[model samples]
Every structure is written in C-alpha cells, then in structure tokens.
Target: MMRTRPLKVALLGCGVVGSEVARIMTTHADDLAARIGAPVELAGVAVRRPDKVREGIDPSLVTTDATALVKRGDLDIVVEVIGGIEPARTLITTAFEHGASVVSANKALLAQDGAALHAAAEEHGKDLYYEAAVAGAIPLIRPLRESLAGDKVNRVLGIVNGTTNFILDKMDSTGAGYQEALDEATALGYAEADPTADVEGFDAAAKAAILAGIAFHTRVRLDDVHREGMTEVTAADFASAKEMGCTIKLLAICERAGDGASVTARVYPAMIPLSHPLASVRGAYNAVFVESDASGQLMFYGPGAGGAPTASAVLGDLVAVARNRINGTTGPGESAYAALPVSPMGEVVTRYHISLDVADKPGVLAQVATVFAEHGVSIDTVRQQGKDGEASLVVVTHRASDAALGGTVEALRKLDTVRGVASIMRVEGE
Candidate 1:
C-alpha cells in the first residue's frame, strides 16, 4: 500500500543541524519510506555558501536561493534549520503558501511569532511542527501540546540552558568563580565568545515563553518572560547555597497562578535543593520537571544541543508531518483557548535568599526583620556572620510575592545600619 511517488523535501540552511538532517534522511531513506508509507527525497538544499563542501549531499541539489527552493510548489516539506528571524520567518511562511508543511528548529522565531506562523500553516492546511525548538532532542513541545492535552499542567521548572548549567556545574564541583567557570566553558566550546544569549538568559527566556504559552494555552511572548542572567552568580553564592542544602542553577520556570486564572514565565539563576532531580543534572545536559494534576510529576532529560541530537528531533517532526501529509490531514495547531493573562514578575510568589552587608551591632537585625515584617515578607531563617565591625546577614524568606520582596530590599537599603544588599536569589523547587 506504500505510495510509489516520493515525497519531496526541501532543506533550508546546510549548516550543522541541516547537514546532519540531510545525512540522516539519505542514510535512513529505506526505513523512512517504509515507516512513512512513501519514499522521501531531498529535493533541494538551500545554503548561503554553495561552495562549501557538504559530504553525502549532491552538488546539483544545492542552491543559494532558499526562497526560490521553498517557492517550488512541488515540495511537500520544508525543514528550516536557519537559526534566525528574518529569512527563516519569511521562508517558512512562503513554504506554507506554496503547499508545503514546515519542520523548524528556530526557537527565537517560533517564540517570537509562533501564532502568526501557526496561522499561516493552518490557512494553507498544512502542518507546522517544531519539536526541536525548545530542548534539542528532548520531546517537550509535542508532550505539552498533544500527550498532556487532557491533563492540566500547573508547574514547569527546570534547567533549560546547557551553557549556563555547564558554567554553574563547573563552579559547584571545582569551586571556580564565575569568570573561571565561564572561561572553562568557553575553552570546552560549551560557551560562545560573546555568550550573551545563553548566559544572559535570553535563550532560556525564549524557551520559557514557548513552554508557558503551550502549557497555559495562552499567548506568551518573549517580552512576557522575565529574564535574569547567570553572569552575576558568584562562588560565594554557591557556598551560601551549599550551606542551605541547595545548589545554584539557571532555571526556566512557568506556572499557573494560585487561582489558575493566570500564568507566569521567568528565567533566572536560583537555588534548587541538592536533592532535586534538576540539581543532579550536571554538565551540558537539559532536564525539565512538568507537574500536573493527574500525572503528578514527569521529568524529561537529555542532551539539549549539538548537531546530531537536534537533528534527531527535526527528523521526528519530519516523519510526523510526512505521515500527516500522506493522510491528508494536519496536527494540532495553537491551543490558546484558556487565553490566561500572563502575570507580571512582581506578582510571582516564591522564596527569596537575600544576603545583606550590615554593621556588626545590636538592633541591626531587628531593623532588618522589621523591614521584612512591614513588607509582609516573613523571614524563614536568618544567619549572620561578623568580621571587623562589618557583618554578612543572610536571610531566607518564606514564600512571598516578588513585589513585597522588592519593597523589603528597598527599605533595607535605606537603613543606615545596612551597608549594601549583597545578593538576592530566588529559592525554587523546594
């Protein structure tokens, strides 16, 4: 019953991920054909540098004009591995218009304009699957979109960025400072030269936006996600965390508010209990915890990046979309039925680990405790260390709104006894 006519697939961006995708398609042609009920052919490969030699790809099949390749109405699928906004966005839209479904690995573009892209696919009656967008090889999107379609997911918390994890893990294991750990990450090729996107939480923030939108069934844009980078994470922070039976990690957290009427998405460096699954997720690996009403808790962990891993996800989507094509159907589109409002960061309720530099004297602690009390932030515990008339007062506050914590810090900074607000981090996964 297999179709003799092969399905033509156009590959855009012959880079790290695109090349691997092509290699896989060619090597696994027979299997894909049998599984998909149709032989899959790599019709064209679009690349900026056509002269660059790509092994296993035909020289005649390469083209510099990506737009034109996708415009060919004969294409059944357009796999976009170009990790950017402009060209990828336009090409993806164009592909749908010309009768081709899309499989993309562009996180930034999807996180930015996923609704628009989904609409484009739906308008043309095509599938737009981006399983490779969020967490490289890990199958996160489809689960949130399809598998958990019946269940209500309340909380999603985990270490989503591998680069930051590597840096933080190195610091925790080797007692290295932020700079030292970042340098090691860069040397090991775990971090980029600039590393702004990964370290600054922008990368994780985009993924958070995607997760929140899907998990909450609302439109969560990139701007909606509150992002705080890991650059400010210091060795002393790790020591403080260790003392509290915790470790620091850059986490992407999405949650439904108390009433389940609103949602919150944020990416930042926080202290998670050492016993938590995410804390043990060392090296450049990704792990996510999905808490639901029925499923209780589910953890998805794997290598979140690299060519081969990402390509695997891309191929999974490709096979799915191919099956849909053969069946003359499409997968689930955007599910913003709830349309819950995304609450601001100030409204987010979580514990705070605040370190303050204060004068070593009586009544200083009382004044600080009064500030917390006045702001409605109850102190769970307080530890003070004095040295040469200067003191480090570490306070862990019970669950409180971010606005109250901000107000407390502002009030503490104004007190003459308080030298500085040394550091403030959120305590999560407790």
Candidate 2:
C-alpha cells in the first residue's frame, strides 16, 4: 500500500542542526519511507555557502538561494532550522503560500510571532510543527499540544536553558562566584563567547513564552514573560541555599491563576529544595515538571540542547509532517481558544529569601520585623549572624504578592538600622 513516488522535501539552513537533519534523512531513508508509507527525498538544501562540502548531501542539490528553494511549487515539506526572525519568517510564509508544510526549530520566531505564522499555515491548509523549538529533544511541544489535549494543565516549571543551568550548577557544587562559574562554563563550551542571551535569561524567557502559550491554550508573547538573570547569584547565596537544604537553578515557570481566568510566565534564578525533582536536574540537562487536573504531576527530563539532540527533535517533526503529507491531513494547529491575559510580575505570589546587613543590636531585629508587619508579609524564618557591631539577617518569607515583597524590601533598605540589602532570591519547589 506504500506509494512508490517520492515526496519532495526542501531544507533551509545547513548549519549544525540542518546538517544533522539532512544526515538523518539520508541515513534513514528506507526506514522513513516504510514508516511514512512513501519515499521521502531531499530535493534541495538551501545554505549560505555553496562551496562547502556536505558529506552525505549531493552537490547538485545545494543552493545559496533559500527563497528560490522554498518557492518551489513541488515541495511537500520545508524543514527550517535557520534560527531568528528575518529570512526565516519570510521563507516560512512563502513556503506556506507555495503549498508546503513547515517543520521549524526557531523558538525566538515562534515566541515573537507564532500567531501570525500559525495563521499563514492555516490559511494555506498546511501543517506547521516545531518540536525542536523548546527543549531540544525532550518532546515538550507535541505533548503539550496533543498528548495533553484532553487534560487541563495548570502549571509548568522547568530548567529550559542549559547554559545558565551549567553555570548555576557549578556555583552550587563548587561554591564558586557567578563570574568564576560562568568562566568555567565558557571554557567548557557550555556558554557562548557573548553569552548575553543565555546569561541574561532572554533565551529561557522565549522558551517560557512558547511553553506558556501551548500549556495554557493561551496567547503568551515573549514580552509577556518576566525575566531575571542569574548574574547576581553569589557564593553567599549558595551558602544560604545549603543551610536551607536547597540548590539554585534558572527556572522557567508558567502557571494559570487561581481563578483560571489569567496566566503568568517568568524566568528567574531560584532556590529549590534538594528534595524537589528539578533540583536534581544538574549540569546541562533540562527537566519540565507539569501539574494538571488529572495527571497530577508529570516530569519530562533529558538533554535540552546540542547539535545532535536538537537535530533529533527536528527530524521527529520532519517524520510527523511527512506522514501527514502522505495522509493528506494536518496535525494540530494553534490552540489559543483560552485567550487568557498574561498577568504581570507584581501580581505573582511566591515566597522570598532576603539577606540584609544590619547593625548588631536588639532593637534592630524588632525594626525589621515591623517592616514585614507593615507590608502584611508573613516571615517564615529568620537567621542572624553578628560580627563587630555589624550583623547579617536572613529572612525567609511565606507566600506573598511580589508587590508586597518589593515594598517590604524597599522599606527595609530605608531603615536606619539596616546597612544594605545583600541579596533577594525567590524560593521555590516547596
């Protein structure tokens, strides 16, 4: 019953991920054909460099003109691995117009303009799959989109970026300062030369936006996500975390409000108890913890990024889109029916750990306690260390609105007894 005629596939971008996609498509052609019920062909590969040799790819099929390749009217599928916005967006729109499905791994593009791209695909009656967009090969998108379609997901917490996680993990295990840990990560190739995007939490914020949208069936954009970098995490922070039996990690958190009318998405460095599943997600690994009405708690963990791991995700999407092409059908499209408003960070309620440098005096503690009382913030625990007329007060507060916590910290800073605010960290995974 398998069709003998081949289904033409056009590949855009032949860099790390794109190259691996091509390699897998060629090496597993027969298996793919059998599974998809039709032979799949790499009709053309679009790249910037034409003279460079592609080991498993035919030289005649290589072209520098990506637009021309996607414009081909005969292509059944277009695999876009070119990250970023510009040409990727244009080429994807063109591919849809020219009657081809798209399987992309562009997280930034999807987080920024997913609705528009989804509209284009729906207008052309094409499938747009991006399993490789979020957590490398962890299979997060499809599960949130399809497998959990019948279930109501309430919260998704994860360590989405490997670079920040590696840096933070080093800080936790070795008691290194932020710069020292980041330097080690850079030398180990876990971090890029610039490392701005990863270290600044922009990368995790983009992923949080995407995950929030799919998990909540809502429209969450990149700008909607509240992001906080890990640059300020210090060795003293790790020492405090150890005292509390916790570890630090850069986490992407997406949750639906109690009323079920609104949602929130944020990325920040937090201290999670060592007993939590996510706290054990060390090194460059990624893990997402999902809580739903029926499923209770489910965790997805694995390598979050790498050439081969990300390429594996891309290829999975390729096979899926290819099968749909053979069946003359499309997979699930965008599901923004909820249309929930994304809440701002001020409205988010969570616990906080605050450290303060204060004058070592009896009445200073009472002054600090009054500030929390004035702001209606309940203190869970307080630890004080004294040395030569100066003392460090570490206060861990219970669940309170971020606005309230910010107010308390501001008031504490203005107090005559308080010398400085050492660090303020959000405590999670209780």
Candidate 3:
C-alpha cells in the first residue's frame, strides 16, 4: 500500500548538480513515488540567486535563506549539493535536528569532518548517505559501506580525479610535456581555470581519505594521506615508462598493513605496467581496484565526474534516503570500529625508478652503487647511457622503505660525479 501524502524534500544549492537533482525529481516523480511508496515533493530549493530562472523548478519554491528552508520542520529529506565546509556543515546538523535525513555530495566536508557530521545524524536518528562524494557516479561509497560489509577489504587503488588523468593520459599518448598536456586539458574543459585542486593531487587525496576510511573501517583524514602532484611529470618520464612496458597515471592508493593493524593512503603519479587494468584507463575516466580477503580482486570503472554523472549519484542516494524515510529506518552510519592509525609516507615500502645525470667516467657507477648499498636499498636493474662527457644512469630499485630511498637519493646528490637528479618516480602495479 502506497501512502498518498507527499514527503517534503528541501534542496540546497541550485547550481550544476543541484539543478539536475531538481530536474530528475520532477521528471521522474511518478516512478520515484511508486518505488518509494510515497509521493516526493520538492518543497523548496535554496540558492544564492533566487531570481535566476531554473528551467524545471517552480519559482515559488526558490529561496535565498537555506537555513530557514532546512528548518521548515516538514522536510523528510535534505539534498545538499553545496560543496564546502561552513554552512553545509551547520545546515546538515540543523536539518537532522529539525527531523530530516541528509543526502550530500560534499567530498571536502566529508573528508575534513565526517565523524562530527555522522555523530550529528546519529544523534538525531536520521540517515546520512553520501554516494556522490567519491568517484562521481561509480557507486563506490555504498559498496564499501554496505555491499562489502561482510568482506574484509585490504587495499584500494584508483584513478579518482578525471582532470589529472586526462592530463596524464595526453602526456602518455602524445609524448607532450606537462605544460602542453595541461594546456590541452584546460582548453578541452577537462581542467578548471586554476586547476590546483586537480593537478596538485588535493582532489584525489580527499577522495583517498574518504575511501580509505570506509574500506578499512578506520578514521582517515585528508591530512593523513600523502599527496604528490603531477605537475612535475615530464615527457622524458613517459619515455622511460615506455621502455619498461609501462604508462604513467595519477593514482590514489589506500592499503591496510599485512597484520591489518595499520593503514596507509597516498596520491601520486606512478608508472604502472601496460598489462595492469588501471593502465588502460584513459581520458577523464575513473577506475578503482579493490582487494579483499573473500573477493580477491574487484574493479569499479566509469565516468568519474560531470554534472549529469555526479547528479545521477546524488539522485540514487535521494531515492535510497527517501525509501528509508518511508520505512521509518536509517541506512548504515559511520563504521570506524577498526580505528587503524594511518602510517606516514616514510614507512611506506615500494619500488622506485631513479634517473641521474653523471660524469661519463669509469668509477662514477661504483660511487652511485655504493650509496644504495649504504642505505640497504637493493638495486633491481641499472641502465647507463653515455653522451659526450655526461651519462644518464637509470636505476630501478627493489622494494624498500621510502625513508631508505630518500636517504639514498640525498647521498647521491652530494657526490661530485652526480651532475643532477633528472627524475624519481615510484613504480607500481607489478
């Protein structure tokens, strides 16, 4: 039996994602009502520009006062697409206090202060679902939170940011330098005007923090994840990657230690073998690879971002929260029972590829080899090419602590024969 009375929903922010949420709500009202067992109404839409025409939204429902809209006391659900910290945080807590569930797409807010927001929702006995927060419409959050609840996830590796992936993909295919690739990405609208958030790995790091928390059932913050931007990736780096049957990608990696006592999260540009599934991911697409105890390897791949794609995720959460409202129940809340300490970058063990400019002399190689030996870092392979009075030595090292690798590099830099450190890249996906 379906309820005839409508469930009121308040929408905050009517920009790209918010507008689409409204459009879908109206256009699919009949279907949503049937699925949710009650009619859903867009009671009000909060926006900065109330006078601007929103195509499918009613003018009467528009308001500049978002705070008042969420506090209307009749709303069953509040869809927050306003991506930030301040008012979004306050408004969400307020919405729960006023008897409404929240479906948000604010990754930054969640990454920074998810525990507090989750506490607020739990305090008010309301559902807090944010499926659109990570990897756009790929359905990562809910799966990690619900579908894989019974399973033990050990590692999560992904290309989370489309902008950086687009730029790196261009550099790999066209052999263009970082600047040239970034300019192309900007022109194609794949990158923002400032592009710092995407290019500098901040965007991916935020997503990594969120994914790490849920996957490991731990509390991982944005600052906990180590971040390295892709701005310094050069065409020569890609050339070396080709020589080793690999390609470069900006990856977000989250892992639980072997004993399952600690976890680590990081974002950096790495060289993955062409045979790896992630290496084939091109353009602005996103893919996440998960390894668990029961489920050996699972991959989720799709369009990571776009108004429509992200809006699709938001709407899916809307339907879920709406159904839960009708049933008088809540979905899964935060699960930080593990509470694993996030390990620092120095403790992370991984392979490295280092390139060095040295004097084309006989004993220069011995000196470079000695540095690695002193640091207890084993060498996998070494390739040295002579050009006039100078030579380039490319060294691929075996698995070693990041601290050891850093020490080895520092020692090499002080050697008189070492002219310059051309590049140092982490190698992964073996």
- Cα TM-score per model: 0.99, 0.98, 0.99
Best by lDDT: 1
lDDT tens per residue, model 2, 1-430: 9999999999999998899989998899999898888989999999889999889999999999999999889999999998899999999999999999999999999999999999999999999999999989998999899999999999999999999999988888887889998899999988999999999999999999999999999999999999999899999999999999999999999999889889999999999999999999989999999999998999999999988899999888888998888888999999999999999999999999999999998899899999999999999999999999999999999999999999999999999999999999999888
Write down the worst ten-residue block by lDDT for model 1.
Answer: 156-165
Off by over 4 Å in 2: none
Over 1-430, each residue of candidate 3 has an lDDT whose tens digit, in order, gives 9999999999999998898888888889999898888999999999998879899888999999999999999999999999989899999999999999999999899999999999999999999999899999998999889889999999999999999999999999988899998899999889999999999999999999999999998989999999999889999999999999999999999998767789999999999999999999999999999999998899999999988899899989988998898888899999999888999999999999999999999999999999999999999999999989999999999999999999999999999999999999999888
lDDT value, candidate 3, whole model: 0.93
**Candidate 1 overall lDDT versus native:** 0.95
Better of 2 and 3 by lDDT: 2
Which 10-residue window in model 2 sums to the lowest lDDT? 168-177
Global lDDT of each model? 0.95, 0.94, 0.93
* Alpha-carbon shift of residue 244 in model 2 (angstroms): 0.7
What's the distance in Å from true for residue 9, model 3?
1.2
